[model samples]
Target: MPLWNVYHPVGAYTAQQKQEFAADVTAFYAHRGLPKFYVVTIFHEIPESSFLIGGTPSGTAVRIMIDHIAHHAPDPAARQQIDDSLTRLLAPHTRDRGLYCEFHIDETPRDLWMINGLRPPASGSEAEHLWVRENQPVPY
Candidate 1:
């Protein structure tokens, strides 16, 4: 029942919106029996130069984002949900265009840990024996 991580690059996310975003992740994970533990979602606003489609800077980045997410989500149900959430979050923050975004959702049990830290459950030192959850699947 831990929180998942999402690495995002998008448009419209602001400093003030951080809380809402966090809540979004919390709710996202909790929906599936997760406690919405501790998510580390980073939003990277793609600058014009950083974004391109068909050799053109996307004038409507939101659509592009939706499409992109669609391509990544292997699950149809999850695809729609993810697209909807991302689109909703970007709509208010979009400028001339909207958002061309990508989010690496690390909520699967197979994605739980690849720890480099010496912490108890993720250590490589004498405490390595204590490192647990490593054999576990990535928590989604």
Candidate 2:
């Protein structure tokens, strides 16, 4: 599971733009063989007075925190690839729009994660494939 938390200044994105951005984020994970339901993107609107950069309020800065539970980079090369992919994924919504963005990914132990009180099946396993097809947690 890749849970993305996006924080941006209030009024930075319209409802339609938020939906599109979330869709893009979700597709990125789905393309990697994760169940679509495993991807979640949350948009947080920060009040101008509350967002800060260099100790001063900034309206153009965006922050992203990503939690990766089901998959993780096993080596430096793989980690770099993930970072590059995320950079490309965020370009349109941040760089192209003149927004300053910073993001970091944290890999959580998969054993500690659960959905609907059930631990997920192994990656690429038949049971996991069923969850992908169903797009929800299912008894294995």
**Candidate 2 structure quality by residue, lDDT tens digits, 1-140:** 99999999999999999999999999999998899999999999999789988899998999999999999899999999999999999999998999999999999999999999999999889998999999999999
Positional deviation of residue 8's Cα in model 2 after best superposition, in angstroms: 0.3
The lowest-lDDT stretch of 10 consecutive residues in candidate 1 is: 62-71
Clash count list over all predictions: 16, 0
TM-score each candidate: 0.43, 0.98
Name the best candidate (by lDDT): 2
How well is each residue in 22-133 modelled by candidate 1, as lDDT tens digits? 6765565445332232234444455656567678875345322111210134687976787577556545444324444443343344234443332122212333322222
Off by over 4 Å in 2: none
TM-score of 2: 0.98
lDDT of each: 0.42, 0.95
Which segments of model 1 are wrong by more than 4 Å? 1-11, 59-140
lDDT of 1 at 89: 53
Model 2 pairs whose backbones collide = none
